[model samples]
Target: MGVRLNGRTAIVTGASRGLGRAIALALAAQGAAVAVAARTERVWNDKLPGTIGDTVADIEAAGGRAVAIRADLTDRDDLPRLVEQARAAFGPVTLLVNNAAFTAPGRPPRPGATRAAAGPPTTAAPRADWPPFVGTPVHAFRRHFEIAVFAAYELMQLVVPDMIDAGGGAIVNISSVASRIPGAGPYRDFSGGVLPGYGGSKAALEHLTESAAYELQRRNIAVNALSPSQAMLTPGLSYYRTDFDDVGSEEDFAEAVVRLALVDPQTVTGRTIGHRQVLDGSFDPFGP
Candidate 1:
């Protein structure tokens, strides 16, 4: 059955660009009033395109309802305000898509970082990449967990009350395939390069999903984690790796999210399934 979210309100973080933006648009297209949250308010160059305003504009232009919310998810104080702004703009928030992640080491790519050149402006900033565990610092792990794990947990705590009061809701935590630990043997360098911090934080997030799902199921709140079956050609990914092929599309990923968002808590809660798994009906939530 197609999803219909005429009266639902949604909060989608990292909606400035890439998969998050696509997810926000998809949800809004389905009739949900979306609060598009992200740190980027304007695009400085082609390297990082689109902004929260751009996302909202696209939704509105398509005859959907959405609001642009500039929020730094790294700030604990911003969490409450984000939820409050969404609640004030629409009614209670019944859909929460925690799609933001700390991919780089420092603050997100800043606007105006590009300088005018003879042909076109280019960002002088060096691309950020995951280093070997021995080379990574302690702060890297902390930052990853802070955004990908703690922030999502905090948001869940903030929204569960509303879901409980409104009778039901859904929380979809975007995760990564890196969360899977390799089986004991000669481990192939298949994941490109797995950063301990990013992978570990996602592992924690999946655990959090299961725990929250178990606790909130009785209250009719579905909490699940989703990961791309393969790497997708997001702007962020392009900025880091240039050789990715056969990657999943943002539209397909967004559709999988919508399905999870509309799932019945009693049946599909706590699944850490892949995008293809969700779409193909091969996700066995109860299986190992």
Candidate 2:
């Protein structure tokens, strides 16, 4: 109903469930033909609800156009194919929501939790000892960068031409508060500290967002990184963190994403901001 993307196509990665699913649904509701991309095609885990098929079904049931794209973002080959599938199913991609990310290894496990109790096997690594960042594996950093930074950059490269030909577009990169680097110590004993690999990758992504936005602004493409102002208990987060009390809602977060998707590139680009910032009228997309 908003932004009037009736003829536009959108690609949303990690859309099988959680925040990504919410975002895809919001985009579809706003009239974009959405391509829901994720690894889950079937219900592999009952604990992790929803799949690309389920997302597509939900969209169709609501009378909006959508396609299920089963893609593993870690697979480089899947990137181009995912874009092509969306383009073929609808039209040139004018919108992208890079919502997929590798769940990093951290989070103090709930007491008496086993390896199986640590949510999806694929997404989460085995529970590490307290002070998890110690001796963190190189592969963990690689995986985080592969999905959160490299894949996003590649997808942006693949879609810019389509957007250029169409005159304009928008890209919203889902980031996290974890990306925030802690200041000088005297730091409190935070139980849920973010691991370096995950936080580092997101920090890199924010840089990518700004760099891309600067280059693409003249071409009428807006690129921005968005994070929740506070923790939200989505399915993924609920599995790792149960300490959040005053949390944000998925609907509000999705609406913020929709707003970013609809931005006028010339006026608003390169913002590394929060959902509450977008909603509360404090986000100056043009500001430093």
Candidate 3:
């Protein structure tokens, strides 16, 4: 009834703010004991707001169970410890929302580039899109993949075994529409901002999700990648565009993830479902 998670436990990465925070709260409200993990535990800078502690307090205040775990997603070594801590706080994680990602704005573009780069290159603006693909540093691009793909893989390895033993579980890899837009079909003119580094990373994550889903289905574990059917106007992105046209809300995403996380593993494994599709009970991602 209404996707109850009563005895389940969940780990929401990047729960410090934005989508992660919203998803964590949603899970807890649905009766899941949530573990909020993020590097930001307290306010050190005014640029970004929200923290694991804040998320936990919000969850607890609403009469739900949650714990905060401070972790840096870039550091692969910290994942096991993070998972261990979550397990200790609640139990084996039944749901893992891999939403943590790194995308720093206003960084100097590649050498020899100047005003030609995308976004405000030298603005004091609170939010700006990433530099052009050619201008992005290799290391910087690698970090996006590290957090979105590699970090997620490491965490999956840790929780998967336990998930199998406990019967079944779900893994939701939070991705972006940037991963697939302006493609080879009739929808080729769509321009929802382009940053190859972040986009490539998300594409790889979706591939990993499909492959993992195929292999893990026998174990009763489902892996799916989800992206907002439309652009999301989060606070970070809002600084650039205040208009909410054709954008989905954070609550929409959180609710979709909740439904996906609670679905039957075998029936829903290996999909790259969108927010609207999940809400509409459209399991066939390729259906017209």
Candidate 4:
């Protein structure tokens, strides 16, 4: 057994399915109680079942504690209730995964081939959310910002105080390759009110992670950004299936998040790390 997160609790936002479900399961496998939150409720019994319900059931079956929380992170008020449920069911959340995200219409469906791009963790070259600055619209930009930026920011504020009070904790924000690097290849605009904002907000979220990591470091809390190659094959990706091109999958992305949450809080802080590099152990999974 690893001392990594034994007896601790973790809250993963957007954990109903896809990468979020994978991370939640991974954390539970390692002995931490998990709080799973998402806007969509997981139907325990459905004709075509989803992973969210399965993840929760798996955790309980394995003798680990887990709770399902219905939270719309974009609505800031929901955060308090989410936190309270986690506390009531498990304990203080020693780990947090900022994994929920949003995208606009027509944003080139994510990059990669056969999920090759989402492999083993390393940095993915960032893509530029285009129409190049001139054609970008304010509403599209704002919509992306709401989920990609503010949602993460607000959730952290709602929970970090409790983490600090308990000594230290870990916060891993799921960032994007689009924000890490810059425009590559031909750029196409996402949809109305969701394009430019998605790119800008992700970039901004990385900045926010750094600032918070610095401020929270002394208290033993670890804060960092983790990005997959392109976007994972999320439910949101159903609309852009052709765009995936085998770059990433929810499982590969989920494992990366698990690797991050397992790190010692005090040791991993103030940096951005990619799944490709960290999963292999040539470098620390969570950069300091």
RMSD of 4: 9.3
- After superposition, which runs of candidate 1 have C-alpha atoms over 4 Å from their true positions? 1-3, 44-46, 108-122, 125-129, 181-191
Deviation (Å) of 155 in candidate 2? 0.3
Worst 10 residues of 1 by lDDT: 113-122
Per-residue lDDT over 1-288 for candidate 2, one digit per residue giving the tens place of the 0 to 100 score: 555677779999989888899999899998999999987766544446678899999988988889998887878999999999999999899999999987623321233555465445545443333225767678776888999999999999999999999999999999997788554577786755655777889899999999999999999999989998988876666555556678888889999998888788887788888899998878666687
Of the candidates numbered 1 and 4, which has the greater TM-score value?
Answer: 1
How does model 2 fare in lDDT?
0.83
| Model 3 lDDT per residue over 110-199, tens place | 324444452343334664444667887898888889889999999998899879888999999999877874455656553455767778
Candidate 4 residue lDDT tens string, 1-288: 234568888898877766777778778777788998875453322221354456688778877768888777667778889888998888777788988776413221122323233222222222334345566677656767777678788878878887888888889998776673446535466442233455577788889998998898888888888877555656444433435555666666666777776566567766677777556666653434
Number of the top-ranking candidate, with lDDT as the measure:
1
Candidate 1 scores a C-alpha RMSD against the true structure in Å of: 3.7
The TM-scores, one per candidate, come to 0.90, 0.89, 0.86, 0.75
State the lDDT of candidate 1 residue by residue for 2-50, as single tens digits.
2488899999998899999999989988889999999877555557678
CA lDDT, candidate 4, residue 256: 70
Instruction: Evaluate model 1: give its TM-score.
Output: 0.90
Q: After superposition, which runs of candidate 4 have C-alpha atoms over 4 Å from their true positions?
A: 1-3, 42-54, 104-140, 181-195, 243-246, 264-267, 284-288
Clashes of each: 0, 0, 0, 18
